[model samples]
Target: MTTLFDRFERAFMPNYGVPPVALARGEGTRVWDVDGAEYLDFIGGIAVTSLGHAHPALVEAVSTQVATLAHTSNLFLHEPEVKLAERLLALLEQPGKVFLANSGTEANEAALKLAIKYGKTTGRSYFVAAEMGFHGRTLGSLSLTGKPSIRDQFGPFATDVRFVPYGDADALAKAVDENCAAVFLEPTQGEAGVVPPPDGYFAAAREIATRTGALLVADEIQSAIGRTGHWFAHQADGVVPDLLTLAKGLGGGLPIGAVVGFGAAGTIFAKGDHGSTFGGNPISCAAALAVLDNVDLEHVRAVAERLRTGLEGIAHPLLNGVRGRGLWLAAVLTEDRAAQVQTAAQQAGFLVNAVQPDAIRLAPPLVVTPAEIDTFLAAFPAILTEAHHG
Candidate 1:
């Protein structure tokens, strides 16, 4: 008998290839497919579900806000929107402006626009972005992204966008100049398989952007909201960016994106500059506020250490190393068999990601228990051995 997969192929767009499983329901860090096959959720909806699936707090917040007022457009004021913005600013510990959008790409596009508009006043016409850094898919943000395969066909991107090697302060310094409008980067290259920059790299980029009179925009989409045991990853580097773009884990599974501008960069937009119809939807903002309330740095730090020790403790060949901050980690495999490992793990009631050929990315829910980590660790060595030699 043809399953829902057949119907999915017949009805849905082929943009994402074909999803392997049809997840029916979830609770905490575990999910069950339509066939009732249970699996531990380490993907965390690609790191969007910060508190985990169907978290009680997130559910209550979303349900309450949705019933009260789902949306009022940007033309009207709402309590949830204002409150969420205020909360983010307070967490930032800095006075700035926040623009809410529906996704990380939109947030990035807004930041890019602000940078461009600011550049118009300063006589700068170019931008610098880190190579291998994943920004977003929108045309504007896509131009800022450094992946050639994603950009090569999407030609003539926002012109004068230059690429610099990530973590190389010298290359970044050389790329930024008086003519540069902004330097776009990530606190850590999360999509580049949990790659973190060297010590003081952000400081160097900050100094360069400041010296060159260019806005420094840090895309904290995958690294913020307690992912690194901090509100934002840049805080670890002690670098305050002129502009910050965030999403993924922001809204606790609800779609919400934000562009935070500091000091002068905050008010770069005048009236009628940029707007979003469903940006800052009350339901999404409420979900984000709940996540903010539940964010526990101490708990997240402990989880990170547990995962680090768990993965490192395994004395297996393929499972060679681990890298990342807090719960957003990558188990570096000895060979380019990450895809195979992910499949094998999934079949064994575990879920992981092959972010790259050699990197198995893991962004589990902040609510994941120590027992869950132990369970995955117990199966991980044999799983790697199977992928390696079996």
Candidate 2:
């Protein structure tokens, strides 16, 4: 049948390839494809759907806010915007200034620009980012991304970015000096196989940055917003970074991102340094506020605990170790069969992702019920068998 998706692919650039399934509707952790086939969604829109697809709270907030006030220029303030900023600040557990944008890449772009501006004053032009880190896809953020494959053709990127091995405190200390502007790391490396850093790595990085007068930046775009069972993954290490970039789940499936500058870091950018037109639109703020209100930290933590226990009980040779904090977990599969596993799981009425060749990442909606977990557990062995030997 000639469908809307087919028409879309015929006209649009073939950048992401053709999507296999065209999703039409969703409720909680389940989504219906255009063919009306239901599947248990575990990818959660690549971790963007915090409370899950079409959550009631998010629907109510977005619907009401859109009807009342969809957008007001940044020149004038709105109540929801003010309230969202305050709420994020409170959740961050820090005093800072926020610059809002429409995506993680944009947020990182603003942050990189801010770092460069601050570096200009300090007479240091170089910034360091960790290896295998996925910041974003824009020029500035792309330059900061540590993966060479993603940066291959986009070069002459915002220059002076140094790539350092992730979780290596000594390497960061060796690279960071008075001449360095900032050191950026993802508390939990999301796109690179859900890699968790070594213990005390972030804290040690903070100490190194302090000693060297370089700003410490944590790109928590994927690991923040209760994804790792914590408001921010860095909280587990008890270290606060100078600059933090947030997105992904911040807008509850809407488009929004934020660059939060802490303490002295906030003062680096003077007036007119950075701005965005649709960064903090009232509708986006309302959706984010609804996400915040629906997710309690304690409840999310409990959900993580339940998932960990359930996954541990499911046995398979390919399933080595499940690594992650909260809902952001990666099931370690043997070799490069992760893609096959994702395919098998999907065909078996579940949705999953192969974020890496050797790992399957599962960032299910926070609203996923215990029964959903049980369903996955029960069907896991067959999925693995099909993936391994199909």
For lDDT, the strongest prediction is 1
> What TM-score would candidate 1 get against the native?
0.98
RMSD of each: 0.9, 1.2
Best by TM-score: 1
lDDT scores in order: 0.91, 0.88
Give lDDT tens digits, candidate 2, residues 1-390.
889788879988999777777899999999999889999999999989999888888999999999999988778789988898899889988999888889999989888888898888889889999889999988889899988889878998757889899989889889999999999899989999999999989999999999989999999999988888888888888999999999989887999999899998877788777888898999999999999998777767777788788788778878887887788999888668998999999899899999999999998888888788888878988999899898
Candidate 2 — which pairs collide? none
TM-score of each: 0.98, 0.97
Off by over 4 Å in 2: none
Whole-model alpha-carbon lDDT for candidate 2: 0.88
Which TM-score value belongs to model 2?
Answer: 0.97
Please state the error at residue 74 of candidate 2 in Å: 1.8
